[model samples]
Target: MATNSTPKKPAADAPAEETAETVTKSAPARPARKSAPGPDVVGPALPAGAEPISVTLAHHHTIDGTDYPPSAKLLVSPDYAQRLRAQGYATPA
Candidate 1:
Protein backbone atom coordinates (compact mmCIF):
# COMPACT_ATOMS: atom_id res chain seq x y z
CA MET A 1 0.00 0.00 0.00
CA ALA A 2 1.48 3.57 -0.99
CA THR A 3 0.96 6.53 1.45
CA ASN A 4 -0.21 10.00 0.26
CA SER A 5 2.65 12.68 0.33
CA THR A 6 0.69 15.88 -0.78
CA PRO A 7 0.41 18.75 1.79
CA LYS A 8 -3.08 19.81 3.03
CA LYS A 9 -4.37 23.27 1.75
CA PRO A 10 -6.09 25.90 3.94
CA ALA A 11 -9.73 26.92 3.20
CA ALA A 12 -10.21 30.06 1.04
CA ASP A 13 -11.58 33.16 2.80
CA ALA A 14 -14.27 35.43 1.33
CA PRO A 15 -13.14 38.92 -0.03
CA ALA A 16 -14.55 42.06 1.59
CA GLU A 17 -16.09 45.06 -0.37
CA GLU A 18 -15.88 48.76 0.66
CA THR A 19 -17.85 51.96 -0.25
CA ALA A 20 -16.70 55.63 0.10
CA GLU A 21 -18.38 59.08 0.12
CA THR A 22 -16.82 62.47 -0.76
CA VAL A 23 -17.31 65.73 1.17
CA THR A 24 -16.77 69.34 0.02
CA LYS A 25 -16.18 72.50 2.07
CA SER A 26 -16.55 76.20 1.23
CA ALA A 27 -14.44 79.22 2.33
CA PRO A 28 -15.57 81.41 5.23
CA ALA A 29 -17.38 84.67 4.58
CA ARG A 30 -15.61 88.05 5.06
CA PRO A 31 -16.80 90.77 7.47
CA ALA A 32 -18.41 93.94 6.14
CA ARG A 33 -16.65 97.32 6.40
CA LYS A 34 -18.15 100.22 8.38
CA SER A 35 -18.70 103.64 6.77
CA ALA A 36 -17.06 106.33 8.86
CA PRO A 37 -14.93 109.43 8.42
CA GLY A 38 -11.18 109.12 8.79
CA PRO A 39 -8.04 111.20 8.61
CA ASP A 40 -7.95 110.65 4.84
CA VAL A 41 -11.51 112.06 4.59
CA VAL A 42 -10.12 115.49 3.75
CA GLY A 43 -10.86 116.20 0.06
CA PRO A 44 -12.87 118.46 -2.24
CA ALA A 45 -16.60 117.81 -2.49
CA LEU A 46 -16.94 117.06 -6.19
CA PRO A 47 -15.55 117.64 -9.66
CA ALA A 48 -15.72 120.98 -11.49
CA GLY A 49 -19.16 122.10 -12.82
CA ALA A 50 -20.77 119.76 -10.30
CA GLU A 51 -21.26 122.37 -7.59
CA PRO A 52 -19.45 125.01 -5.52
CA ILE A 53 -20.43 124.54 -1.94
CA SER A 54 -19.22 123.09 1.36
CA VAL A 55 -20.41 121.00 4.30
CA THR A 56 -19.86 121.36 8.02
CA LEU A 57 -21.25 119.97 11.24
CA ALA A 58 -23.93 122.07 12.96
CA HIS A 59 -22.72 124.50 15.60
CA HIS A 60 -24.29 127.29 17.65
CA HIS A 61 -23.04 130.42 19.35
CA THR A 62 -24.09 131.75 22.75
CA ILE A 63 -23.91 135.50 21.96
CA ASP A 64 -25.82 135.75 18.65
CA GLY A 65 -27.45 132.33 18.76
CA THR A 66 -25.91 131.71 15.32
CA ASP A 67 -23.94 128.81 13.86
CA TYR A 68 -20.18 129.27 13.93
CA PRO A 69 -16.96 127.21 14.09
CA PRO A 70 -16.86 126.90 10.30
CA SER A 71 -13.87 124.57 10.71
CA ALA A 72 -16.29 121.79 11.64
CA LYS A 73 -17.93 122.28 8.25
CA LEU A 74 -17.06 119.99 5.41
CA LEU A 75 -16.36 122.22 2.37
CA VAL A 76 -18.10 120.33 -0.35
CA SER A 77 -19.67 120.95 -3.75
CA PRO A 78 -23.37 121.64 -4.19
CA ASP A 79 -24.12 118.12 -5.27
CA TYR A 80 -22.17 117.05 -2.22
CA ALA A 81 -25.41 117.60 -0.38
CA GLN A 82 -26.69 114.51 -2.17
CA ARG A 83 -23.61 112.63 -1.16
CA LEU A 84 -24.23 113.78 2.41
CA ARG A 85 -27.74 112.40 2.09
CA ALA A 86 -26.27 109.07 1.12
CA GLN A 87 -23.97 109.41 4.13
CA GLY A 88 -27.12 109.94 6.30
CA TYR A 89 -26.40 113.60 7.01
CA ALA A 90 -29.50 115.72 7.55
CA THR A 91 -30.14 118.61 5.16
CA PRO A 92 -30.11 122.12 6.58
CA ALA A 93 -33.49 123.82 6.98
Candidate 2:
Protein backbone atom coordinates (compact mmCIF):
# COMPACT_ATOMS: atom_id res chain seq x y z
CA MET A 1 0.00 0.00 0.00
CA ALA A 2 1.28 3.56 -0.89
CA THR A 3 0.50 6.73 1.15
CA ASN A 4 0.33 10.43 0.03
CA SER A 5 1.84 13.15 2.35
CA THR A 6 0.77 16.37 0.51
CA PRO A 7 -1.60 18.65 2.42
CA LYS A 8 -5.25 18.48 1.19
CA LYS A 9 -5.79 22.31 1.38
CA PRO A 10 -4.04 25.58 2.34
CA ALA A 11 -5.52 27.83 5.06
CA ALA A 12 -7.89 30.54 3.63
CA ASP A 13 -5.94 33.29 5.47
CA ALA A 14 -2.60 32.22 3.92
CA PRO A 15 -3.30 33.78 0.49
CA ALA A 16 -3.84 37.34 1.90
CA GLU A 17 -0.46 37.32 3.73
CA GLU A 18 1.33 35.99 0.62
CA THR A 19 -0.28 38.68 -1.55
CA ALA A 20 0.94 41.50 0.75
CA GLU A 21 4.50 40.14 0.70
CA THR A 22 4.46 39.83 -3.12
CA VAL A 23 3.22 43.42 -3.50
CA THR A 24 6.01 44.75 -1.24
CA LYS A 25 8.68 42.80 -3.12
CA SER A 26 7.45 44.00 -6.53
CA ALA A 27 7.03 47.69 -5.55
CA PRO A 28 9.05 50.27 -7.60
CA ALA A 29 11.39 52.71 -5.88
CA ARG A 30 10.73 56.46 -6.19
CA PRO A 31 13.44 58.73 -7.68
CA ALA A 32 14.80 61.75 -5.82
CA ARG A 33 13.57 65.12 -7.18
CA LYS A 34 15.92 68.10 -7.65
CA SER A 35 14.93 71.61 -6.47
CA ALA A 36 14.76 74.48 -8.99
CA PRO A 37 17.02 77.54 -8.72
CA GLY A 38 15.70 80.48 -6.68
CA PRO A 39 15.21 84.07 -7.87
CA ASP A 40 18.49 85.18 -6.24
CA VAL A 41 20.55 82.51 -8.04
CA VAL A 42 21.75 84.45 -11.09
CA GLY A 43 24.88 83.90 -13.20
CA PRO A 44 28.39 85.10 -12.35
CA ALA A 45 28.56 88.78 -11.28
CA LEU A 46 31.02 91.28 -12.82
CA PRO A 47 33.84 92.69 -10.67
CA ALA A 48 33.93 96.27 -9.37
CA GLY A 49 35.05 99.02 -11.87
CA ALA A 50 34.48 96.64 -14.78
CA GLU A 51 33.72 98.60 -17.96
CA PRO A 52 31.58 97.70 -20.99
CA ILE A 53 33.28 97.16 -24.36
CA SER A 54 32.39 97.52 -28.04
CA VAL A 55 34.04 95.88 -31.06
CA THR A 56 33.53 94.47 -34.55
CA LEU A 57 33.44 90.73 -35.07
CA ALA A 58 34.31 89.54 -38.54
CA HIS A 59 31.82 87.06 -39.95
CA HIS A 60 33.07 84.12 -41.91
CA HIS A 61 31.35 82.11 -44.64
CA THR A 62 32.31 78.49 -45.23
CA ILE A 63 32.36 77.18 -48.79
CA ASP A 64 33.66 73.71 -49.74
CA GLY A 65 35.34 73.39 -46.31
CA THR A 66 37.10 76.75 -46.75
CA ASP A 67 36.32 79.79 -44.53
CA TYR A 68 36.08 83.33 -46.00
CA PRO A 69 35.98 86.34 -43.68
CA PRO A 70 33.27 89.03 -43.95
CA SER A 71 32.66 92.42 -42.28
CA ALA A 72 30.49 92.58 -39.13
CA LYS A 73 29.98 94.81 -36.07
CA LEU A 74 29.67 93.57 -32.46
CA LEU A 75 28.96 95.62 -29.31
CA VAL A 76 30.10 94.13 -26.01
CA SER A 77 31.39 95.20 -22.59
CA PRO A 78 34.89 96.77 -22.29
CA ASP A 79 36.05 93.94 -20.01
CA TYR A 80 34.88 91.33 -22.52
CA ALA A 81 36.57 93.27 -25.35
CA GLN A 82 39.92 93.23 -23.49
CA ARG A 83 39.54 89.53 -22.89
CA LEU A 84 38.98 88.91 -26.60
CA ARG A 85 42.06 91.01 -27.50
CA ALA A 86 44.15 88.99 -25.06
CA GLN A 87 42.94 85.85 -26.79
CA GLY A 88 44.37 87.23 -30.14
CA TYR A 89 41.02 88.41 -31.57
CA ALA A 90 41.03 92.04 -32.76
CA THR A 91 38.86 94.32 -34.93
CA PRO A 92 40.10 95.39 -38.37
CA ALA A 93 41.89 98.75 -38.56
Candidate 3:
Protein backbone atom coordinates (compact mmCIF):
# COMPACT_ATOMS: atom_id res chain seq x y z
CA MET A 1 0.00 0.00 0.00
CA ALA A 2 1.40 3.37 -1.06
CA THR A 3 0.35 6.47 0.91
CA ASN A 4 1.48 10.08 1.05
CA SER A 5 2.71 10.84 4.55
CA THR A 6 4.69 13.93 5.57
CA PRO A 7 5.84 15.29 8.86
CA LYS A 8 3.65 18.03 10.29
CA LYS A 9 5.00 21.55 10.78
CA PRO A 10 5.28 23.21 14.19
CA ALA A 11 2.41 25.41 15.28
CA ALA A 12 2.69 29.19 14.75
CA ASP A 13 1.92 29.83 18.42
CA ALA A 14 4.88 27.73 19.50
CA PRO A 15 7.98 29.83 19.99
CA ALA A 16 11.01 28.80 17.96
CA GLU A 17 13.76 27.55 20.19
CA GLU A 18 17.38 26.62 19.80
CA THR A 19 20.30 25.83 22.08
CA ALA A 20 23.10 28.37 22.45
CA GLU A 21 25.49 26.09 20.58
CA THR A 22 23.17 25.75 17.59
CA VAL A 23 22.22 29.43 17.71
CA THR A 24 25.85 30.46 17.46
CA LYS A 25 26.47 27.85 14.78
CA SER A 26 23.67 29.24 12.61
CA ALA A 27 24.14 32.91 13.52
CA PRO A 28 24.98 35.47 10.86
CA ALA A 29 28.64 35.99 10.14
CA ARG A 30 30.60 38.65 12.05
CA PRO A 31 31.47 41.80 10.15
CA ALA A 32 34.99 42.35 8.88
CA ARG A 33 37.19 44.54 11.05
CA LYS A 34 38.24 48.03 10.03
CA SER A 35 41.71 49.49 10.46
CA ALA A 36 42.68 49.44 14.13
CA PRO A 37 42.91 52.86 15.80
CA GLY A 38 43.12 53.99 19.40
CA PRO A 39 44.42 56.73 21.68
CA ASP A 40 47.59 54.75 22.19
CA VAL A 41 47.14 52.85 18.89
CA VAL A 42 47.81 54.08 15.37
CA GLY A 43 44.92 55.83 13.66
CA PRO A 44 43.50 55.04 10.22
CA ALA A 45 45.63 55.55 7.13
CA LEU A 46 46.07 59.06 5.70
CA PRO A 47 44.88 60.07 2.25
CA ALA A 48 47.27 60.88 -0.58
CA GLY A 49 48.41 64.51 -0.41
CA ALA A 50 45.91 65.17 2.38
CA GLU A 51 47.13 67.22 5.33
CA PRO A 52 46.59 65.63 8.72
CA ILE A 53 44.95 67.45 11.63
CA SER A 54 44.07 66.45 15.18
CA VAL A 55 40.43 66.87 16.06
CA THR A 56 38.24 66.23 19.10
CA LEU A 57 34.94 64.37 18.77
CA ALA A 58 31.60 65.73 20.04
CA HIS A 59 29.51 62.56 19.85
CA HIS A 60 29.83 58.88 20.61
CA HIS A 61 31.47 57.08 17.69
CA THR A 62 30.82 53.44 17.10
CA ILE A 63 32.58 51.06 14.77
CA ASP A 64 31.51 47.44 14.53
CA GLY A 65 29.71 47.94 17.87
CA THR A 66 32.90 49.24 19.50
CA ASP A 67 32.20 52.71 20.88
CA TYR A 68 34.66 55.57 20.90
CA PRO A 69 33.73 57.96 23.68
CA PRO A 70 33.11 61.63 22.85
CA SER A 71 35.81 64.26 23.44
CA ALA A 72 38.50 61.87 22.28
CA LYS A 73 41.21 63.10 19.92
CA LEU A 74 41.85 61.57 16.49
CA LEU A 75 44.33 62.52 13.82
CA VAL A 76 42.41 63.12 10.63
CA SER A 77 42.28 65.75 7.88
CA PRO A 78 39.32 68.08 7.24
CA ASP A 79 38.04 66.16 4.21
CA TYR A 80 38.51 62.85 5.94
CA ALA A 81 36.71 64.24 8.97
CA GLN A 82 33.59 64.91 6.88
CA ARG A 83 33.79 61.46 5.35
CA LEU A 84 34.09 59.87 8.77
CA ARG A 85 31.14 61.85 10.10
CA ALA A 86 29.07 60.70 7.11
CA GLN A 87 29.88 57.14 8.06
CA GLY A 88 28.78 57.73 11.67
CA TYR A 89 32.38 57.90 12.77
CA ALA A 90 33.94 60.40 15.15
CA THR A 91 33.32 63.98 14.14
CA PRO A 92 35.82 66.78 14.62
CA ALA A 93 34.71 69.43 17.06
Judging by TM-score against the true structure, name the best candidate: 3
- RMSD (CA, Å), each prediction: 18.1, 14.3, 9.5
Ranked by TM-score from best down, the candidates are: 3, 2, 1
* Least accurate 10 contiguous residues by lDDT in model 2: 35-44
lDDT of 2 at 83: 58
> How well does each candidate superpose onto the true structure, as a TM-score?
0.28, 0.29, 0.42
For residues 1-93, could you state the per-residue lDDT of candidate 1 as single tens digits? Answer: 998999977657844444342234457776554333433223443675664455554442111222334235554556655655465452362
Best by lDDT: 3
Clashing residue pair totals per candidate (backbone < 3 A):
5, 5, 0
Clashing pairs in 1: 53-76, 54-76, 55-74, 56-73, 56-74
lDDT of each: 0.46, 0.46, 0.63
CA lDDT, candidate 2, residue 27: 57
